[model samples]
Target: MERPRRGWEIPGDHVVCMYKIIVTPNASVRGVASKVIRYASIGEKEARQKQEYERFNAEIISWYETSKRVGLVMISYPPEMFDAKYGGIASLLSVIAGWNVSMNEILRVKLLDVFLPEKITKEFEGPRWSPDKIRRKLRTGGEQNCFLRVPIYPRLAYPEDYEHRIKCLLKKAPEIAPDIIADSELLFNHEFCSIDKRIDIMSKFNKHVESMMDAKERVETKTGCKTLFFINVSGKPSYTLEKTEAVKEAGLDGITLNVLTTGFSLLEDLRSKFKNLIIYARANAHALLTRGNSVGISFDVLAKLFKIAGADIIYTGAPCGSLDRVKPLDDHVADIRHRNTIVRNPIYNIEPALPSISGGVHLGNLQVNILLAGVPLQITVGDGIYNFPWARNNLDRIADVIRLFKKAIYIITQRKENMWDDHEFRELRHKKCRTYFMEEGKCVDPTDKEIKDVLRRWVYPEFRDVLEKWERGK
Candidate 1:
């Protein structure tokens, strides 16, 4: 296995200077990366020279030149820019990115990584519940806590859907208890779900949460293990505050906030405002892309930001998952989990945040993900467990999958070397049926034909017409 490594070269002066630069839409007189600095300074003469000569030099951020249009330039900032007394993650970022956003029409700044001084880390609280506390609280399958998340597409869906989903989970709660059962971001409160302009948003939301709470009680009664249910509460500050209050009032365990959508600053606010509720920060490619052209956040930088903002758990890319272009996935996971690894800044002792492996995770790739991301994990699988070929059988099949998943995880975690030689491991093949297309050891991107085939196979005779209509429209 290749270990993660970093290389830094500083001149004799020991000045912290050099920023990796990339150009966006607007082009300066020359195709050089210095133009990015021009845009980053937003054409401020004094600032540009300081950024170029005094503060730092330029180096390209990317490893390769994918395009002549983009240049990765490194820049170093002055020490005086950091104010120790009023130090914060947001303030530090503002120093780096303040003028850049307004610099050019499409000039964007994505932080590949940041060096957090002790002064900065001490500014905000880290995770309240570390991995140990979380496992202790949830009472997982064995020594390790396996995570499960069920995605609910609609609150207004038919009763049987919830029954089959929640009730089935309730039945399996006792024997195959997972540490966390989170709501997918898909099931968030949206304007479309509201009934009328006159209707109070929280009133409708409270009604929906009531059903979830009732279901949670039933599961806890059977399981004895207190399984936490996190509802995806993401929106504007006003809407988010109202829903968060409603979630707390309803006696729910926690709420999931889409950090990229709500912004990192909002996460800090929620962390301060609601001390009791467990805040889980979530983000996907789609959500992050919507953050605006000026703002670009890399995987590791995003992790540190969440930690600084006080998120208990943050989702990371799976080594072999649906999301693409996330190379060095193992390194990204480490960036979140390992303390004092981001940089050797003397000021603050930054703690580790729980790294969550989600997206296209299943029984097939459980051990593989563990090996890549490292153990003491929060693995959230959706279709891998729920959409299993034989999962419909409430009593036996779901338990079987859970047991096998735990078994594989246990072996790999206990014997790290076993990951290399699968000959020692069992369960080489899957017993369940699946409608979606997938590939081994990589994320599945099913072709159009494969999707159509799955739809035809799974859809009932009555629903075939609707499926065909949708397909035709596509």
Candidate 2:
């Protein structure tokens, strides 16, 4: 008797009715354990099951020729498997990376990427605020097209202290005005500094900054740019919604969510509800899934998913500085490129999200970061700004460090010639390269002579030639 046909075998014009996944199959075996049957009459049932498995293996599994066991495979699933309407990112994730159940046949698998049809793409609202719109809204112009963001950790005494800290930074060097000031992911709703208090303090501070900029009288206030405050709204669904409501009510600029922890569904919900608020999606926790060589999902896939879930800005790990210790520079660069492509590339008519580089980024390697990105970026500094060598002695010098970064970025971006060869670039680097030395952990302030020695011995030698090569190619 003829065996029952598999989905792929019985398919006719299933292009729109299918979603595809590329996975590296480390092991492929029968999902069900074989059982010994006592009766000979039941042999036909087992024979039919065996035939079904063979048909699936032959027709559906498109394996790539490789030396490894089982090899890589591309699997396609019928649209019926997904609930495109009711089921959101969770369901899509299950369809793509749920190897434990739906993909149980593959004992070990690494999900590389996923391609959803237009029908699936149309179901979700992508980023409401594209990077271009954000730039226009902030009235960012000239050589300073890329955004400078500073993150405030939760070491402050109270929510008001956070406001005071930001005010102090801007007051010291108004030119150091960042486009976006965000609360660290570690800053949650503590008893002393609740989300409400933080929002109230920051919203008022934002207004004050706007007023100062509008007046354009005080040289200390003449930043010629607007600052946006993005509070961390990552929490349970109910708490997130409540905090989002407070943010909107207080007329705050934006909210950030740890997408990996809170899940992508919350991101979509926030986008749908608060169409105007900029949603920054943090995927720092993704290292658990993406760090492996031959398991879990790829950063490329996660980047795409973040964009699809309506994140205006996504924090992709930095390619240079501190994160290098965790992974090779090449790997980090590859991940950043993937994220940049996903955010910048026009696909399915969805608005693009802004790719942000954060960990261990500073003025020294800032030019290198921009060159590698080859696109507009949100260059975020944490300890890079807060713990600068000059700032260690006097917090006011933090502004000077920011000013130095602005000068360097302007020279690098605006100049037509190679930045590395430019006199101004070299001068700026020599004067301020020491700022990059003060990262998250290493807080010890080095002497100016020590700084010069370190730069000459390590930083300049390591990055100079590389930056020159990159600049020439660009």
lDDT of each: 0.51, 0.63
Compute each candidate's TM-score over C-alphas: 0.65, 0.77
What lDDT is obtained when candidate 1 is compared to the true structure? 0.51
Error (Å) of candidate 2 at residue 335 is 3.3
Query: Per-residue lDDT tens digits of candidate 1, residues 320-354?
Result: 45553343444333443342222112124444556
Residue 44 lDDT in candidate 2: 33
Q: Could you list the CA RMSD of all candidates, in the order they appear?
A: 11.6, 8.7
Report the number of clashing residue pairs per model: 21, 0
Top candidate on TM-score is 2
Worst 10-residue lDDT window, candidate 1 = 194-203
| Candidate 2 residue-pair clash tally | 0
- Clashes by residue pair, model 2: none
- Where model 1 places Cα greater than 4 Å from the true spot, the runs are 1-18, 22-73, 78-90, 101-110, 140-142, 150-160, 190-224, 285-295, 326-347, 392-400, 414-474
